[model samples]
Target: MTTATPAPTPAPAAAAETGVPAARRVPVARAYRFELVKLVAQWRIRLLVLACWIVPALFVIGVEQQSTLPSDTLFGRWMHATGWAGPLVVLGFAGTWALPLLTSVVAGDVFAAEDRLGTWRHLLVAVRSPRRIFAAKALAGLTVILLLVAGLACSGAAGGLVAVGGRPLVGLDGHVLAPGDAAGKVALAWVCVLAPTLALAAIGLLGSVTLGRSPTGLLLPALVALAMQLAQLLPLPVAVRLALPGYAFTAWNGLFTSPEQYGPLLIGVAVGLAWAVTATALAYLLFLRRDFTNPAHDGPGRRAVVLGVLPLAGLLAVTAAVLSPATGATGSGIEQAKVERSVATAFAHLYRMQTRQLNRPDVSEARLRATAACDKGSIRVPVRGPGNDWHCVVSWHLPGTDATGTAVYQLDITSDGRFVADGDGPKEVNGYFLVRTPTGDAPNPLWQFDGDVELLSHSKG
Candidate 1:
């Protein structure tokens, strides 16, 4: 009876004809989920997450611990920490060691690691179409990029908040930004900073597909990055500005100030996207078409080499064409020695003019001490004022442009209540002191407060 029943089941000839089940269609969501499975297995990704939390926390602790640096005005003190020189002291060391490297670690290995484990073949087999596989990988890489960007940015802001003490953030324009506004600006600034790295991701892709090794993609992109960074400093044609990976960073800084401008940043994003698309297309074409028969004998196709080399050649060609250097520093650059003197001298002159108008006594030089000092690219000057009394504080900006660093110095003639001076209070009294840091071409009465100088005219010395 059992044998008869089994024979009857096989009588459905139509089902028997094909002798195989219908192909199971993989939904896009499932395919994407599969890609996620592959990504989670990566060791580099795990390490990146760990580093993101650990490093920034340690930095924040250190900055907060050193909170003894007296802030004359709370905002001014915070500005000191955020200013060019100050943040450079903090974030610079952190950024150089890991943050920049993380960008490569995540992006470079995402595609290349598949080849390392000989998994690309398996992936291609499951997802028959190259376009789908490529799209999945791109999406995965980009997702990781966003994670890293967000991670780094959030960690940095947290660290800065703790270190600087939560308060109104002052901008380069000297306008006080509310805590809510400052938080948003800082977050936006970090995002803006991360945008430039997209080009670096493109470079990583080219290396990933062709080299098929994590080291190749990571190291080559880093070397290329250093070269491009140095190339940016070279005197190049105005058009060349659009090509640098960091060209977008400068524009983000504008967002921190009043009158938001995005022209340069937009141009940078466009240029970065163009490079990324071209590189990704070539990477996909080579990987999909090339043979992977033997591990040792199989190599990246010739098309891969041309694709990679051409970009490198184009970069080099542009550098060679645009590089222009001066025989020596500009006149202002050479006269940097007189900066301290110029600051004091300028303050003395301005003081005389103001005092004359107010009909006050000519302040004695003996009463004058260097309270604050700074220089434009050309002339250095020291701002002098009454430190103890908080008398009239005076300052002046020399000539030329400074992209970074102290731009102007000011002296408070009368101390209302705030501002701190290290050493002898008398040392700052009737002396030149650092009142504010100068940014760009113009002088603004705002700068970050380091431990020593004070700017709040309301605060008496």
Candidate 2:
């Protein structure tokens, strides 16, 4: 009887070498290193980095030549004044969509391209574990985000310095910042942007891993970014606004002002990290549960429906729900006493600030003696909430003369202690211009506050 001895048990797979079947984890550091190497080798990534470095130079040149300043954007009003202004203007534009798009270019493609090129099985064979691969891919995407942001920041600062000259920057609070100090602030502002940029990149990676479609991966994150921006403009709750990534984008605005408010900046960082963690966790969980052995079994349509269409539809529904008009009539019944007192105080303080900027330290708020009486509409509706018909008659004395005039101001106040008032005040309310102290002459666009104005106090006088 030829009894064949049982073939020696095949050596346990490398994964089982640890004695535990599932605990066999690959070295994440090695995986991450390889991912970076792979990304760095891509021609497209090189081109993207190159673009991030070069485009700002072109933009600075182009904007410098333009006659009309883009006043609608913050810092844009001052773009023609100093080298620092160009960077601020670029930052504002980037916040709208450019930054998200640029960062997403690589992040969105990182994982989806594996699916697109039928490389998942190959990657799994080479890398061994899905979780490790996912972690590596995410790390690589984040690295790409850092590179893109850093490149833009350095290039933007260089472009601004080269094209506009390193002149002192005028702070939003009407203070003058020395060139060196302003440059540091500008660099810091760009660094702050990294938070939102990384958040957007994480979102792109999530879409890439879950949807596995190149277009969806690219479009989804961009859409989310744009939607966040739009939501900020909507009549959303303050809590919701505070949690949004778009709100974080504007956090840099405080850096350019005196007494730099780091509260918003910190909040922005928290919101961004929250977004990144949430997105990365969800993507990783989904990737772990997914089967990558058979491309034939892959359900792109189902994935699109589950991950892409449904989320987009839900976003639209939420937007509609939030924007739906209420049956009850709404009105901003602001208080007259409060409006008069607030406007008068603001006018005095702002006028003094303007005078100080003009080198006229003699022009004091006490000397101005500003006062106002406000009225609503043609018929006297109850002096309360906001209305377009609300008007104010402000009277103030211009120093060195008994010159006093009643400037008619049309006021529009929001529920949030903010107001926009247009007046036929001195010089058509064309912002204050710096002048030679004694003469107090010339109309230089030095410091101007021609648009919206917010209230100082919430309560009535």
Candidates in order, TM-scores: namely: 0.62, 0.74
For model 2, the local distance difference test gives 0.67
Please identify model 1 stretches exceeding 4 Å from their true place: 1-19, 67-99, 163-165, 297-302, 311-461
lDDT of 2 by residue, 369-389 (tens): 989888886564877665567
Cα RMSD for predicted model 1 = 12.7
TM-score of 2: 0.74
- In angstroms, the error of model 1 at 174 is 3.4
Error of 1 at 134 (Å): 2.0
